[model samples]
Target: MQKSRLLMKFQSSGHTTAVLRAMSYASPSSKLKDMTSGIEFYDKITYIEEHFEEEKDVLVQKL
Candidate 1:
């Protein structure tokens, strides 16, 4: 069964929330062991946002 259909069958909000939390715990993105890596990712995106006007939507390249 598709996840969306499974989610929709829940008539109770509490059950839905519990299932969603369980699914979140099981997801791959929840496995980041290094907190600093998340902070670095945030810093990178903010740096790009601050410089977006200068880049003018140009493809960012790594040197």
Candidate 2:
């Protein structure tokens, strides 16, 4: 019933392509939608990367 077990079953049955296709069309659950606000996953990654870059530049300038 777990996600990994389900995925393994699909893979063992050679239904990986079908599983991928279904997942590609699947939408986020309402719970997930309701929980999300402000920056998204990739946006958060970029925000952190940019912050680190700024800090690195400041450190380099001080050295």
Give the root-mean-square deviation of each candidate in angstroms. Answer: 10.7, 11.7
Task: Give the runs in model 2 whose Cα sits over 4 Å from its true position.
Answer: 1-39, 53-63
TM-score of each: 0.31, 0.25
Q: List the residue pairs that clash in candidate 1.
A: none
List where candidate 1 sits over 4 angstroms from the true fold: 1-37, 56-63
Q: What are the per-residue Cα lDDT tens digits for candidate 1 across 1-63? A: 333333344334556445544554566553242112233334455566678787654645542
Q: lDDT of all the models against the reference? A: 0.45, 0.45
Candidate 2 backbone collisions, by pair? none
Candidate with maximal TM-score: 1
Candidate 2: residue 54 lDDT (0-100): 64
Q: What TM-score quantifies how close candidate 2 is to the native fold?
A: 0.25
